[model samples]
Target: MRLCGGHSGLLLLLLLLLTSEFPPGWSELFGWRDKKVLNVECETTGYEIVGDDFLVLCPGHCVGQQPLVWGSGVYASISSVCGAAIHSGVLSDSNGGMVRVSKKAGMRGYVSKFANGLRSISLPKWSRSFVFPEASRSMAESSQQWEQESIVSTGDKVDGRRLSFEAYRKGFLSSEAKPAAKDVSSPKGPNPFQQYIGRNLGTASRKPMTTTVSPKKMNKDCNVDIAFLIEGSWSLGVRRFESQKRFVTKVVEELQKTTDGAAVGLIQFGHETKTEISLNKFPTLQGVTLAMRKVSPIGGTSNAGRAIDEVAESFFQKSAGNRREAPNAAVLLLDGWPNDDLEVPARVARETGINIFIVMVEGATSEELASGVHGDFVNKSVCRPNGHFSLHTDRWTASSALVSPLVSRICNTERLICSKTCLNSADIVFVVDGSSSVGLENFPALLEFVANVTGHFEIARAGTHIGIVQYTYEQRTEVELGRHTTPEGVREAVRRVHYWSGGTSTGAAITYTRREMFAHSRSGKRRLLVLITDGRSYDDVREPAAAARKEGIILYAVGIAWAIKDELDAVANDPKSEHVFFVSDFNDLKTVGPKLVENICKEYNALPRN
Candidate 1:
């Protein structure tokens, strides 16, 4: 029964190929008989949105937010790769305006580029979940390569279509992306992924099934936990390199001695994908030091989304004891710009309650860094008493020395400056009427009005809170003021909002406050509700208004354009009392908001109950 040498060799080769190439369903799932059907259509005209399939592109999307989207199978396979199902769709309530899903909030996924009609997504097995811009962004090339490595041909069935993966590289061009051939233009540049691509041949194509976890949460104290997602795109260089390493080392050393719950890790990055470190879950100084020591500055664009997935996995996985206790902080030392985006990371940080303090040691201000950050979080420097104006990172200095101090100043020894400040039971919420009469045309002008209005109070006081409740026919919570009292939270709450349609429901919201909301206030602290409307309430705002005011609530109302100034005047506790305001336009509301806040400050219960 002894087999020949060549036969034995052949058998071993087959076994190796079967195990390495296909993990589970290698024999039955895929085969070389599979073929690829490439249907690609390019058009100069942008597609119009008819309904669910064809959605009209919003003007705002092109200007700001996740304006980058293309029809591709990229995101579809992401959930499979991570071994978790992630839903991807825009917000339902969103209109022709910007639509961003809370699910894909942080940066994660492969580096496949997609535009109006051009997109390449390759969710390959090598694409493990991790954090940092470099690892995820590199996926563009890796995915392209994986696409090339795949050999698939489908029987094209409506329900059960079998796909195969023989091998991907198809000389220069075969099928899949008709133009997916790696641009072999240069050996050096930003597109490092291209360099590794070589051609082979075509076969069949199969959609993927996977999940992407955040590097942060995965890298928890289980082993090497703390990680710094350093940006390594071509946009970056030696500029922040030196500072990145120094701060990283400093943080690592500090983390070592402390019996902190997590281990410190490091991951250098660039482009939109790549995780220098996955949620390795390594515990102890050896693992932490090893991870920190392995960071090698290299290629890719800044995609913060992956970092979020990393943290999401790493943060929430901690034991219940740790979860029950007050949390500790995880610091990220980022230098350079995030050329691409993965906002989900920021959301993960918030949802998982991770105290993610980003220290960007670069010349860019907070605004510039914000353009690159995961959740578009603002700087904590600009805070006001009534919670109107918060600072943007653009407002902060970039020098390491200056930036570190600012980071320290913003993040109190316990938690976020904004979150803690409001914890003192003093975040304020203001409901405004931005109907036709009190509206601003452009977003900038509107933001300015909001800024000026929030600017009056001395925010430095025991953390005065600020939140916005905008009403048309309906009401929208622009800023959830109580989440955090720091200037940063204030800005994020207001960043992506606008004054839109709807009638005034002054009374309903007032009732909601009395019944559902304000009652959930953290402690026995004074709450203020300021109302500014240009006209009379569409509903019976009187009874609720009277009820609230009678319950020792600080209720104030203002009248503007065609509004029943007399009725509003009565809504205020006192007509000429500093509690009342009147405005002609949206900008004017800002003026009145500050004045009211200044008046409230004068009623200082904050200083010395002594």
Candidate 2:
């Protein structure tokens, strides 16, 4: 036992090493070796802290694989460094500690460290990298002076990334910590990421995209009966409301100068709708502009559906200033989505010959805009499909910039041609009951309904062929199958149909339609017979209706006041709800016009496209 002081000290150290279990730094050494076994082939990778999170680009591996231990093995072991401080209370006491997910980087990992905490990550000398206009070397130099921290992981896939705490706080990821004008050049102004964000996400891109209408095509003389349906809710503050009014005035002033002169009307809508100017009220551009200036915003909830109904019922009438031959249009200025169901009313407006141009400002969704326009209208005609004739702006001030495109689309009559292309392929015949109950006064309403429905289809010899037959005690052929080649011609023939006031003969009309109206030559097309009667049939309808169905004719029945519902149910195709319509009176026909047209279009659209 007798030994020198240095030997004794060495002996004591050896005993301490042998006796201690789970010693400090030893566990870390073993953990580091274990991690190295699990880690990938230590290839140099790049990472960038986008917002509050870090996007680590793993080359050969995909998401869900183990994260690379980003450091040289020489510095504080991986466990004591990044993994240990996390489990211990040391890093948790930091003031700026808050967990956030990457908003734009589109990764699943959360930021695992803060400020000085990043020092322990042991970023290799070669690990610095970035994306976009900056060169890798320059980015590394700029980032080296600044301490950066964050982490990324992989999880269940979704709309790429969600819950961007940093993007929400700082607006968007900065192109450079300090962007020099000479360093970055992109088609989307200074930031190329602006276009990237808009294309992927439905948010404001770094630089707003502005679209303009071709001026050469804009100045041509054209006649349009246009009504401006504006949002006047409090959310669209007074300044924004005034901006909307100015946009409308500018459009009207330009349109009125054309040789044919467009008739402009105004409707300021919120919880309540006010007719600021009727279409017939102001014939000149000066009168319309002055009227628009005096119109004030009435604060209330956004109810666009009601405004559309008002425009369809009251705004686009002859008494209100609508010309029979002029193309009718309604410019809807929306700041937000409607508070009610917009589909049905929008359908009615379009079926009534009004071309809806939806101008969506900030706060409107792509879904709402798509539902507000006619489903069959082409993209170019409405400026864009899904959100047709729609111009989306980042802020209220940007709405002024949309006037040219809106005017060009609304004024240029050529685009309005597609509004008539509703049905793709069909042989449609109108079987009308010209009974005495549908007197001279109501006969015009009947013809108007027929004209409205006829206008919705593509009336070409090869597209959707149209014919009409008026029935009383006897059936009279008003329009022959494939007789008219254009929608205009078909509508004219419908208008010319004379009222033959007599007794109801629904069965005879159905039999005549099946035997004569649906010719063998037109058998290739979908046969559709729309029967309109106002009273009980004087003759039996069951046998003829069965015969019509047997011949492959799809029957749709519309009955006005005093007409039998049982007869309508019997005459219509198998599903009565899908094929039959009933109105209280002649004036109520417009109510069901859009629904009938919608069903017809739905049937046609569902057909297999060749």
Error of 2 at 605 (Å): 9.6
Task: Please list the C-alpha lDDT of all candidates, in the order they appear.
Answer: 0.40, 0.56
- Candidate 1: where are CA atoms >4 Å away? 1-425, 439-447, 455-462, 605-608
lDDT of 1 by residue, 1-610 (tens): 2447668545533443343232233323333122221211111011110011111112211211112121122332112111110112221112222111111221233443322211222222221121111112222233343333332322231111222223323232333322222312223322211101000001112111111333443332211124456655655566456556655555444434333333333555554334554333343444554665556556665554454444434332322112211232344445534444433344334322344556544345476556634333323211212222221233123333443343333323222322231123344556667666554663344555555445433232233556677777766767665654445556655666777756677777677665555665544455777776677777887788788778667777766666787667656665346667766655555555445544554343233320
Clashes of each: 100, 2
Kindly report which residue stretches of model 2 are placed more than 4 angstroms away from their true locations once superposed: 1-218, 364-388, 417-610
Which pairs of residues collide in candidate 2? 109-153, 382-389
